[model samples]
Target: MAKITFHGAAGTVTGSKYLIEAGQAKVLVDCGLFQGMKQLRLLNWKQLPFAASSVDAVVLTHAHIDHIGFLPRFVRDGFRRKVVCTPATKELAKLLLLDSAKNQKRDAAYLNRKHLTKHSPALPLYDVKDARRALHRLKAVARGEWHELSDPIWVRFHDAGHLLGSNMIEMEIRDRDPPLRLLFSGDVGRYDAPLYFDPSPPPPCDYLICESTYGDRDHPDEDVLEILAEKVNQAYARGGVMLFAAFAVGRSQQLIYLLQVLMHEGRIPKIPIFLDSPMAVDATRIFRTFSKDHDLSEGELAPPNSVLDGPNVELVREHNRSKQLNNVKGPAVIISSSGMMTGGRILFHLKRRLPDPKNTILLGGYMAAGTRGRDLQRGRPTIRIHGWDVPVRAAIDSVSGLSGHAGRSELLRWLKDLPKPKKTFITHGEPDSAESFAAALRDQYQFETVIPQLGESFELGE
Candidate 1:
């Protein structure tokens, strides 16, 4: 009988991995690195329970680090099969993986230099060479088409609408008497979100694996533009920089577009906008390259006088130039990654700006627990950065509608049209969020729901 195992993201919001075994064919879905919290991050260093080479292929659902970040490490660990994803995901994955490798190396060197690491000599999880090697294995396929993985095993991708290239995976096992159809909801996106279409409806499946990142809560009923305009005006009036900690790929681009829209509408002043992450700069280019992948019209994405590009905007790619931003004054907007403030160019900006009461730090999306972003949201007096306590004197604010993940109602809406699966496994959320979501599904739709623990396995068919 076919079986499946939850490798990661079973009881947590990050590190998504699932293993499916059918006959002799094994396909691993969404191999990603665990982020947030020391315990979870340590999982990245431990060897996988299953042999990497034993897996025939690795299929991806999106380009988010938590969904696709571990590709280089997986490749480095001896997985030789192709990594299948949408064409946009294939392109974005390369940028993300390379940036992840670079960050790993830089962080390790920093820790080693400061003697802060537990290891005698800190080492990166994988280097750029490993990332490059992984990139060579990426195979892009058009969305909504069935592709054979092995004999009697096939997979299809449907737009998840979480990011530009995000997708939901529909897998079919033909070897069974009745083909076992399974659907994996890869970070379902918000309904009617900007720059992306609504999530594709779930195909009928016997089993369903879904994410519950915001399962326990819903976003506030506030216009995103009005909220952003208010924040920008407040920050500008204070005469200090408004720093945005955003995800490099989706969030960064969204903020840029929205800021432009606000400026054009005369809702907010046209302040100098700085994109300070190299990965974001490149990811924005990719966003422009794949205009059809997103909901933006040709006019919105078009060049020279595009809404995505403006005269006041600057893309900072050089290290020295990024440092120069420390001198950049207020009435300006600075966007950097990582969104959770776990790591990235955002840290540098936070260190420089967090101590100034006049400065405003805007969190663009959901901040996972155990991250600096969450700490700030919780009203922590100080944040630890580079082994020093940085006072949290800056005004902290968040936009209600900026999150990419579907909230409780939206998640239900996304699943409202689907036929109840025989069993629905809830993964990719904190214990409370996942349980809440599972209970809601059971009560509302009569779904046989299970919140699988990490490393748990279940039989697919009787």
Candidate 2:
């Protein structure tokens, strides 16, 4: 029997790690960092319950920090094995890991300089050197092809349609009769979503592990173009900078394209649109490089007529330019990263703009619990940032239909056609979300489901 363990993303939406063991071979599905609450974030620093050296390989789902952020630390902890992923994921992972290291170092230095951190030195978890070391081990394999992880075990990738090169993992173990099959739904994507293809239909399997990020809710049934146009016009009318806290990889590119479409259609006047995250600038380029493989049309990614390369769009890469955005005036849009306001340049923008009534802070996507973005979404009076409780005077608005994760109904749709598995483990969400999805499956399809707890283990087949 093969044993599977939930190391992260078991009871929360962030930090996604799973370990699968078969005899002498051990394969980790994803090595992600825990984010959001201090309790979860603290887990990132704790020694992994299992020996890092014991794991033979790490197979990635995508390049999102929450899903693939802990590689440097894992390497530091003595994991000296191939980190496998799709070709596009390999490119994005390098960019993200390097940026993650830089961001940690910068944040740590800032905390130390201001005497804000409890740790005397306030060092980064792992530095750029560590990140580089981890990158050396990354090996890219194309989608739809089987690659052996070790003896008695093989794996394949299928497009998840979540991000630039996201995928779901399928693993086949040779020990069992008919070969025990397992599928890992790596952050299922929304159907008919812009810029990416719909998630591939799940193939038959004995067991399935799925994400429940939006398990309890469905996205609003509204046109994203209409909602975005309205939000943009309102922000412009207020005569202040319209700040968007977006995920650099996907949401930032999507917003730029939609905004460009609005201007082209004369729905909203042409305005200065600045992408203020250096990592975002790089990621956008990577998106262009692989645009042909995605669902975006030629004009959406190609230069000259490219949606992301509109006349009013500006890519801010230098640190000085990002800082200058703090002084940006009204009738302008500045998009920054760390989507949930956990870290990155978004903090500086929030501190400068959150107290201005004329400014509008648009939350473009999901905001995990304990994040400053969640506080803003809930209309909290004050947000504690960098040791200060910044008052919330800005108009807080959110646009639905932009989240990358599949919602309750969509998740059901993704699984409805597949044969019932021996068991389905609902994970990668908050406790309530996991439980609610589990209940829905039982009621609607009578599928056996389990809400795995952190560090929980299970035997797949006899």
Per-candidate Cα lDDT values, in order, are 0.90, 0.89
- What C-alpha lDDT, on a 0 to 100 scale, does residue 377 get in candidate 2? 87
lDDT of 2 at 76: 94
Using all chains and alpha carbons, the TM-scores for the candidates as numbered come to 0.98, 0.97
Candidate 2 similarity to native, TM-score? 0.97
Instruction: Indicate which candidate wins on lDDT.
Output: 1
Per-residue CA lDDT of candidate 1, range 351-450, in tens?
9999999999998677888899999999999999989899999999999688999999999999998998999999999999999999999999999999
Residues 234-315 of candidate 2: C-alpha lDDT, one tens digit per residue: 9999999999999988899888887887787788989999999888888888888887656654123334335478678899
RMSD of each: 1.5, 1.5
- Flag clash pairs in model 1: none
